[model samples]
Target: MTIVNQLKISAVSIKGAKALEQNLLEKISKEKYKPHDLFLSLEKISNIYNVNKTTAQRALHSLVGKNYLYQIHGKGTFVAPPAVTFQVLVIADYETGTNNDFGSIFGIPAFLRGVLKKIDLEKYNYSPVMLTKKKFIEILPDIELIYRSCRGVIFFRNIDIFVKTLPVLKDKNIPSFFYGSDALLESVSNADCLVYNEGGITDLAINHLLKLSHKKISYLYIDESPTQKKRFNLFLQENKKYKFCTENDILYFKTIKELIHNNIIPDIKRLLKNGITAIICGQEEAGVYFLNKCLMAGIKIPGELSVLTISNYPICALTPVPLSAVHIPIEEDAGRCLELLIDIIEHGSKSEKHISKTTIVRRLST
Candidate 1:
């Protein structure tokens, strides 16, 4: 054979080996194939790849570390499906929860579920993964593992963790998105977000109270989130108009129990001290808690203090006050959030952040 022809033949042999390796990897990605099936008789893949049984064994061993396949003592080798997309991993966050309170933890998940229900799953088969408030830094390795399995992620109510891992996703060309209130507003340009319109919603709740002639308002809030802070701040800004209705002004509290523990019974003390007669809660859960506290303190509702909230908790009606509240459009917001996430994943648009508005729903106790 000519020297040049020999060189060409050698190159083809090397190329073929590499091609076989890639082909196996792709098969793993495409289906849940088992290594035992590939090595069913050892003679099978050998003929298929035109490689000796020893070379095939070496290739299979190399893929073991890559998580493409697994070995079973009695059964055989099994192939794992390619890691699912971002949505598949994040679905947990979209499931319904017991209550709608930040402190409840399930509130965010329930809201996400409401959103995911409206999304076209065929196009965006992603899931919402939950990360604890302080576990971001320690979770990088696991996050990286998921990255190898899936190409995208939908982070839920987790900013610090998302920020820490987002750069890695960008480096690996993995798409990352956020839903609900974003803790990393500046990094928002790098990630898509479906944020809640706390300002508009708080405005709606405050306006609802105003229509009820509730001038003496106090807001019982938990400052665990930036979103809640903005809601409280906006409520204060709108409280300026209450001066026109009566001298009873608005006040803020960190926690319902804290106010009581500090001997500062906001509803009762307000009535006796400042003549404050109405309350607007940051969330419906807190509204219920406050209403119960008021009743225990012998405070009359609507006759002494009207209670309203910014969130919708069905249990609010069971409260002694039968609290009134503005319903946050959680279901609609979820749909819009998933739609925006899909837009980011498919079209690569990272400039605009979608914010859904909150609407007021008047009920008793107003």
Candidate 2:
């Protein structure tokens, strides 16, 4: 027999059990049980309906099969929300000429893997929506449709888009969780956030160098994102504690393109002459390039100069001198983002913001 026929045959054997199931569904639809509210157990079901345990079980299972209820393994069944579709939308930033052509340089693939690992496939469906800044406006109507269809949204590396779309999402009462730095969260009110502690990473990298008796440290950064600005500010604050490198030691390039096109060789030589013995790089790509230039200029790693990258990219491991880095916990942050989003969806409550800590991954360069 076909699956539908088998389900019908099973329902017939239970007798009057089908009526019991409909009554239960009616109560659920009438808001007798709120979303995430627990349902009766097998014993309670049988007692209340004056039916056998087998009949109660069949009735409950039938409701589950119809998506009227959901059960957690080892935990009891709960009243499913009205229109509980079990779909989550993940919106990611897209950048041209980058790994995955989107996301941060550290690796979008690893971040996505972390999210997937934490998600329960049997209970939820995951859908990803990637768009560049230019494309977002053009396809916004379609995005609205997509947003309305999903239960909640998880945003990654797309602060601009998130900010722009926040109003509409709020109007529709859709819960959203942002996976980004604390600075990014400051703009949006009432939304859940899973932040990467950019300031903490700066502290970890700078403190490690200070302990090594390296005072004259320079910092390099590319891009003007809020997260990058926060890192730069934290580096300055830490430098104040030690009276290390002066204002001149801090450098900024508007974009990675600017960093590549401009020759900063003379500037590096000047810093080296000024007793700058160590450098903290904020961007991974720019850091790798600076390391190559320093090596080519006959600068010794750690002996004459030391370098530390503020990134957790796998490429850091394969570099000529494995780069010492303040490793951002991308995987942990992604997992936390998923967990928080799900909590908001199930309980209909806004979760408090969370910040993941960073760790220093020591390697040859430091």
Candidate 3:
């Protein structure tokens, strides 16, 4: 053979051997064979790949050099310790005990479920770290350890907590993204955010009520966060265009405990007396509470009061009168955020914001 042809053939063989080495490593990782049990004779690899013994030997030697496998003096080649996996950390404002109960939390569980479903298990692993408002300060010292271990982070929390904790991740140059409505604010400009359009959700709710010819409506909420504020503000903004409700019709409570202690039923009675026909609720729990209270007061749903919730959980359907709602696409948004995070990690791309659309799900309550 000509020298040029011989050189080209030799290069092809080397490339083939390298490819075989990668395939072997992937196989070892997938099978999870013990180091001693993974030892394979040169003949075994040759037969497995249908390559010559010299090619197998070259591939095995390359793996050994890269610490993917080890060779002993007399023993055959063995798999090395598994390579460290890329970890994506998820931080959210929730207690560990409430992790499994979607009703107790907001849409966080649904969002997390979507993220878990879409993550590439072969290339990356995820660790969910729940942090409550009370425990956030306690976890500050351990932030460095978390930052060092995780390649990226996905945050779903209030603006205050996010603003406080984000600096640690930023200091380490770790890629991160915010998932939820709190990320919509100008204060959250630093991180890439996947936000549900509060305006769109509010518009959907108000438009639905308007279509139903409900003129006197009210907006109700229990908590005051940036997200809640956005929803409430959007409700007000949309009300201006529709003229369905006024500022006096808005009802808010500091907490659920306060709502009960102050007797929310009495307020509902008063709202009904004032000719309020429909209510748009910011929190799902608040929607449930209002529905129950209205029912207990012998108020006929959709006949006397039409309730609509801006939430993600399907529990709304289980109520006495299945609630109509502006359903936020929590799972889809979560998956999109994870995809964006992976893109940034793999491609060194600039972080970008995404706004997920909301749709009104018509049901008995409306």
The order of the candidates by TM-score, greatest first, is: 3, 2, 1
Candidate 3, after superposition: displacement of residue 10 in Å? Answer: 19
Candidate 2 C-alpha lDDT tens digits along 1-366: 899998886776577678888878888888878888999999998888788777788889999998889999989999887553355666664354365322355556667777877776565555444445566556556665655566666777677778888777677667777777776667777667887776777778888988888977888877654465466576677558666677777667888777767787788888888888888887767667777777777778868888998776787787788888878788878877877787787787656877788888888888
Query: What would the TM-scores of all predictions be?
Result: 0.63, 0.70, 0.73
For model 1, how does the per-residue alpha-carbon lDDT over 157-213 read when each residue is reduced to its tens digit?
A: 566666777787678666666765543465556456777666666667767777777
Q: Which residue pairs come into collision in candidate 2?
A: none
By lDDT, the best candidate is: 2
Best candidate according to TM-score: 3
Total backbone collisions for each predicted model: 19, 0, 0
Cα-based lDDT at residue 317, candidate 2: 84
Q: What is each predicted model's overall lDDT from 0 to 1?
A: 0.61, 0.74, 0.73
Inter-residue clash pairs, candidate 3? none
In model 3, the number of clashes is 0
